[model samples]
Target: MITLNNKKPVNIYDPAYDKLFENLQGNILKGHGRNFTSHIFLRFEENKKDKVKKWIASFANEITSCKKQIKENLAFKRDRTSGDTFIGFYISALGYSFLENFNSSEKETDFFGSMKDANISDIKPSDWESGFREDIHAMILVADDNLMLLREKEISIRKEMNGKCKIVKIENGNVIRNEDGAGVEHFGYADGISQPLFFSDEIQELETKYKDVKINFSSFFPLSQVLVEDPFLKNEEAFGSYLVFRKLEQDVDGFKAKEEKIASIVGRKTDDEKEEIGAIIVGRFEDGTPHILSHEEGIIDNLSNNFLHKNSSNGKCLFLNHIQATNQRDEASREMIMARRGIPYGIFPGEGREVGLLFMSFQSDIKKQFEATQIQANHYKDLIIGQNLPQKMNLDCFGKKGKEINVENFVKLRGGEYFFAPSIPYLKNV
Candidate 1:
């Protein structure tokens, strides 16, 4: 827990791989806040298991002899492992407190507000199943055997300890390809499709280069729905970005049943066609095209996401999809985008609450990206999840997916929180 440059020590709780987890914890203490940098990714290799154990001992020893009579605390743990890859993360109370103060803005440039809008206070880390905690949006993925050993060599071991375990990391497009899952979550409906563009110095330079181009408010101030301006840093201070980690209790079986029922009612045809049902209701196909245009013309294109279609009779895609609903494709103005990094969590046991996905997101503005979806889910029943108004929704299509959805008893929002994910540098200093 030593300070570096007067900065707080970052507690790394990733346990995707057990060995990596123990290694990270030990290294944090031995390195004394020197090794674990913020916003940077780390990878632990299997061959380096011994190296990781030594590092864990170093941190455990420090905690054992801590002079302050350290108070015992409860933390979240996620136990996901591949043969070679395991994924997990953790958050300290100090980090959790930062999440509590995160405020959402009413709109971009609307800096002043009398009171906070949403009440995510009731949301609790306790709501998570067992081994999970709120974490920053970006993740560290490692498959390199050498870097894994290199990580171990960096650890400074002081003593030996137990609680040592090993885990593996799973490799998927989520980490490498920007668009993973063909536009859906692991449970399926394309996600991260619509994200708020950050108003970084680099973005500003781009604005300058394109004179005729207009960076919409949403682009500059992504997640306007939940952008909270820090009073201390009011106008110029770099605004804190909020991350909401939710361990929602989802009824996957129930969800699947409803999806099937909707499909039958919509007169869906092939299995592939059934798969497309989710996309239809969501508006954008997995490949990111409007179903109306994609199926009708039998065409698919990722770039089609950028092609703005008029919201008229000839509109290529329906407006209900996650991408279109919040992106403000043909609206009077553009809305902010919050990058959603959510996954389904829960097990499919006989009765108890199953767990999966450590749902997460990063937003300069939360109100637009996050809140807009909430509004749609509550009002329209998140058409993607087969949740929508019984008959009021305009689900007029050939497929049963969007055509005849009950709209009632669809996706439910259990609980959630607002967190701030700081940069690597910020983590070291904070």
Candidate 2:
């Protein structure tokens, strides 16, 4: 098992790791921290692999490195101003097949088999949106805090693609904020709270902020959790991480309505008490408070990364809750955790508006990490986001038991694809 610690810090810029960080892509070690993002899915035109390679080589200069990202992050911390637009490039298995003379056998087996062919969980490719059903060879992610600047960047990418590549689909994602000014999903719950910490400063900040709490779960992870060798790059420093992108459409009104029903079934009367029902279903209150930590919401000191589900059988937090099903806080569960960097997209509460989360995660092995977690969630019937059919869950809330309520769908799998975020050096040399 991997040991978890808070004493040691992973200094990415240290002499031993500086070269690796220089070759690694941004948003793998740390997020780009941009508010607006656009994912441009592309397919190379027939007989245009040479032009596509040239475009990729030229665009390699625009890719952000982890070293540069960390410097920008520190500068942002010192001053409120953020750096310029951040960009990321990823290629799918089909993209690799299109480019000649590229060796992909060194990659994980799942990379060669696209997400559409993976048959993950209960997701059906036929049900997916048309845009994702088509072949997507590559994706370009452009992000910036300013929407206008983000649009300009997208336009520039489209213009640069010319006839060499066809833009199959474009997904625009904007960060949705809650009343507390933190990022939240369409269901109004704080998201991305329990991400794996890779850097020394990140670990330090988490430890210092939650020093008083007894942290049962550890968020600290080594670089091996996400980094894998890039087959196309000969340098040992060249590494990359597999990326999983899924578009999950949430039914906000349906979920809230079910929450109300669950609240009434659990015998809660007050609004605050009723809210706890939602927390139980989600494994966290809307304000990001872990349900196992405290019954009430907004306990700022309750470290999200410091809770375990060992007592879940006692009914403090339902076994079928989203968090518990996805992560039971066990030694083996730690290996399955992914560095989630998703952002909510589209407007909510408006008629004819389609809103949901643009889920994105980085991992070393898709099958062992993302797919395993999803399969576990399916078995447990995760009430929030599990793609399984409607099923009943034992609602043992507030010391009550023997009550089973059928939980319906709240999230739909719209579309997704798996791609590899390769090293900047690999792209430049391709």
Candidate 3:
């Protein structure tokens, strides 16, 4: 119900919203980046309920203004560094139950359901390195330019929580920003390219009125598409959003090995030619260039949002191509895509550096947005990708060179959980 328009509701940065803002955490309203990120998952002791509440209250000051988070600190310490790097707090459904009130059995998303139902509990014991298959209560994400600084802050936080909570698992993720094949995922394709535009008038203005490829925001997104309304407060305007955290382990070596085989099958010999073949499968070049009308020649900007498959000829990006397979702009699904906030993760990052994405996304409804996309990516299936093809339910035209592009399950879903980041006001009351 909360919608932003020509009439500004209230600036999200206003001091009056201190309580509400503090309740919301980082990477909810905006995008998050990388350098060095340490993910520490936790499980709280049942006896220390009061202590846990006190610890949550301690974040009151840090969560507001949120100034010194990873991004700001990165700028200040561009040359120097801060021992007190940015910290983000997130909780699983079980953790929320540990809080006072507001834990009345949430079933909004399968993410909050029993772990077994999530199918995450079935991950092989060896893949336990990804963590969280067992019952995980909370997650803390700390990022910094200096690894020492990051570790120091993490150790201090742990020291405070000491006996009250136990560290379930700790994983360190390094950055691969601008290092040759940087900005590219382990699969060697541009990753995190097509994120949804946050629905603000200022942002919408830039995309719609003044731009050449006018975006019909209403057609694509509902007002509350990604906005989280405060269920605790009576005047529940927009408050917080849903966070979907998934640890996707990418098979860099396997993907590369498969790409070469696919290249030969399609007759691409040279490196550049093989790369293009990979992109066709991925839906974009390593630089994030979507290959829709790019082959059509006059259109397809690097930052293009104008291209929709229905407008293109029959089979521009074959029905099963990664990019084409993912694009769902129909009235039912235009708003289903969540805003991606994942960063590439690994100790030593790169094409085959044992890397993967710390896949994260935010949305109003996890079931509608994140789950919808997950369904399509789970398999090429019979999912529709328009190219003026016949309206048959079973997409007969979905393949590469008249043969189905064998989808290599390159990404493994090691672990994940859903959390509702309530508004600061709601948290203050709690």
Candidate 4:
């Protein structure tokens, strides 16, 4: 049995976690590191539960495990030639109800509810895309570095589901990188910089790299933050995680135009000065520089995730900024952090195109982690990505104060769902 302390970080490389890692699915502990992804939403045909179960059991053999993913990641880091495809399978609460014979009382409460009824602030099912309005039983995530290979894999899966299931929607995602090769969202801000670290080696690498800098923030987290016992599997090592997927479309033209307008209103005259306003709103510059540490973009190292909002009360980082509003840099905020493995989708240099992020986050609890953070962000009106209706923001950074500017409707939620990425053992046995 794997022992864990609530306050201590779980060492994923330890021998005690061997069975857990073997049984757990990939892309949960860490990212799959693929450039292209296809989200295949599936709905099994009526009275086809037995066929669906058999197909899933056979397909589970293709899903990557945490142990194999770690090895692949290390091999890529050493020689940079690993180009294998990764796959993940997730079942919604409605999906489970259709397949399993268990009672409602035996089900996980949060996993059984649909995202349409989630009641997240500012999210309305009426505003969602039509594809998400239908009943979605399960999703198959296929990702790869090669576009051709990714497409081939998607076709193979589609062909396999011929009469057993219907494809509800297929959302394709591609990684958009900046000139510096760092991953960025459609809005031009660096994405997925701040994350929870589970492995000891990853934590050690960061500590060693930032040895000179006085690191105050801790990214290390226990496995319990993301993993929960699989209700369908009896194995002691069987575990699963809750996945929240949202297709957030960005209005590039509107956001950039209003960003400049807000900058001008904040009394910024020069181009460099105007850039700081965007930084204040995003809590990071376009080039991923932490605005709390440096006023200029690309001036400081981009991987600096060690700063705290408590120390920035002097107005270096605005209290209403995206990062500060979502994460208050307190002990309570630590529990709200989720493993974000989202990727950008649609046309780049977005000009009236469906381009945005396929926001995917894995956590142990949706209510405590994702929903709570969204509520907190809504309360503070996080200007960049908060879903709440647009409101005036206080421009209290960069030696300026008392200037309130209104910027509205930059990011819109198209559609999404809540899913449980079950253990490989459970899938095989079912």
Candidate 5:
């Protein structure tokens, strides 16, 4: 990760370590959806803090051989093939409470405290599921291509930590890919489109279409871009990062019906047109092509993600679209975006389908990285139609999708937790 005279990596990414300042948990920057994923949240019994620490030491030891997961993860991405299981450990705010050494902040910047503010979203921290609503000690993320293997690992892990800690909830997840192998969420839109490009010794080219901008590893990103070094780490100097977990329940049918109904009034006579209307609201064409750059010639390359919002003239791309609203065009937005590793989960049978996304991400700061985006997505109902005075865009109106539009909330937060996964060396000492 040599700093070039021009501010880009001169040649290639340095070795992963020399490139990434922090020893990141390998799974943080990995691709989405190979096969199976299980998110397990736990709570330690009172007076058993020592035992829980010992259990983590043991769990960390069990996955010692997997520290090279960064290498394996990239290989799988390159081959589009399934790799071995990838594991990561994280601890929640409540988990930090049990630690006598931690000096937890009571400020609104803290995720747990912000959740209680109510201004963050309609949902409150108290509304979360049992373990996540309160004293969640830790989270164990198990990912693999084999569902059976994941299940076995989950069981074995529980057996190992049984009395030391207890399982509060587990959301099983997997990549919902199409026949052609394009990743998508349960809502049928292309997923995993947004990722930051890094100029490193290893990263040679843009990995995804959505990542139109690349920053030198030494410039903005490092261990600092992905993790908090102090307080969260026992050694304050080793590798470890903050994790944000969100259980988003998607109203799949509701969203589709709304889209079709809205598109119908726009005189949409074909499925393509209706889908296009949906794309306008989503700010993309389901194939991960941004509406701001989509054309009859097909998806645009370099301009697909016009980071400058240069083409957003005459309300061409409404501020209401999910991507448009959340993908802020301001230069300051660079810090708001983070690498998202989301997985779709749920059954597909019956009238009342119970499927959604297990949205997870890593960031340098929750407030700046994830929360800022969330705030932008939730608000911004006023649309500045071209040069017109700011006004609300009526959803029922045809062609208003291009106006200042704040799309309705299609996903509800169920439960989640904030955690810090420390370095292997620090964990052993803990």
Candidate 6:
């Protein structure tokens, strides 16, 4: 039994690890797909660079010891929708102090300095502004079984490392922690629903559109903009996408109060039944399933219900729904859909502002998937957006059903930026 820092040995042969070990010839097995739970956000103290690296190395070592187990679990499928056992880790940009100086509207800043020389002919007009501010470093984990077990392992790894890493916050279920209950950012509307899917054909098509241009796929592989000889080689590379990890602190009590008021205005039966009210407003449940499809045709599966007979005329989700607002519901028309591969982070703080999603997604187009979501948020109740389009200026987010519900500044952009998650080979070798 291999172990690291006294942690229990993970079993690769266990049914939970099939996906990871699926192609390992005859020697190994894989894991199953399970819910990713027990998120911990560790913020390192400024000037503790060495300590941070050491802690990360030790934690990585512990995870590496379980490679054999990871390879043998049947639950390791890349796109497992059910209870799959999996573990993931990726360093984010949050540990840096330079990120604090970025202004949301600033055209120039230290963080986005690298992007200035970039030839961005391939990017859409709407996405030009989002290419700034590389803040909020992050790591991700997914597992098949209990969240507590995962949390326990994380704590052990951190403790054994003995570094300056402090538990800045923790949470579960889409940025909202257990403590805050129903109040959080990207909570009820099925956050990360309208992400962009990767297609090689699109890459080639993109090349034709912009000769000698590099298109950055956040969570996928092939980090460079240069096209490879064989496109399939790109597939052989990483998933060919990028992941966005965000740590947003939610205004819990405030959100709950607002939601209650919205429900009452919508004539909801009770406050506890706000999920239903939310579903009506967003057209989808909290778990990424469409309430309209769920009750309309008895479609209960979350994933299937999300895509089946989705309404795209005015957007698959409601105008107020976060995902719809983000993507503008142009998915069905353009065959665009982004897969969200992230979860909530931080334990809901009963008092202070500390809770939100670890928030990551694999998308081909950040603007189509990520930026779209932000625009939708602003459309709903973004203070920044509201401030820009004040009521005195005849600004409004809702129409008929929405006019009754006063959405006053709920979502806020703490900070973020575009990042490139290289493939395994690029990550290790390049």
Ranking by TM-score: 4, 2, 5, 3, 6, 1
The residue pairs in collision within model 4 are none
lDDT of 1: 0.37
Q: Which one is best on lDDT?
A: 4
In candidate 2, which residue ranges exceed 4 Å CA deviation? 1-8, 101-112, 300-302, 311-314, 394-404
Candidate 5: stretches off by over 4 Å: 1-23, 64-67, 74-82, 101-103, 106-118, 199-203, 207-223, 230-237, 295-307, 347-350, 382-408
Show pairs that collide, candidate 2.
none
Against the hidden reference, what TM-scores do the models get?
Answer: 0.49, 0.93, 0.78, 0.94, 0.82, 0.50
Model 5 error, position 389 (Å): 20
Residue-by-residue lDDT tens digits, candidate 1, 1-430: 1111212222323222222222222111111111111111122233454554344334333321111111111111133211221222222222233322343242224321111235322234445323333232222221212335324422321112122322211211222112442433434444454443332442454456555544332233322333333322323222234555444444556656765765677666577667666665566555556564565312653333444545335534354454445444544324434555454433232466553344555544455555555555445345433233355554464322343344444344443344443222222222
lDDT of 6 by residue, 239-321 (tens): 22334544444455666676566556555555436655555445555555565445332245324223423444443335444
Per-model clash counts, in order, read 52, 0, 5, 0, 7, 67
Model 6 regions lying over 4 Å from their true place: 1-87, 91-152, 155-240, 251-256, 259-277, 285-318, 328-336, 345-355, 365-368, 376-405, 412-419
lDDT against the true structure, each candidate: 0.37, 0.82, 0.59, 0.83, 0.63, 0.39
TM-score of 6: 0.50
Instruction: Report lDDT (Cα) of residue 60, candidate 3.
Output: 43
Higher-TM-score candidate of 1 and 2: 2
Clash count in backbone of candidate 2: 0
Cα lDDT tens digits for candidate 3, 282-336: 6666666666645322245534444566666745556456665566555565757
RMSD per candidate (Å) reads 13.9, 2.9, 5.8, 2.0, 5.3, 12.7
Candidate 1: worst-modelled 10 consecutive residues by lDDT: 65-74
Q: Which ten residues in a row have the lowest lDDT in candidate 4?
A: 3-12
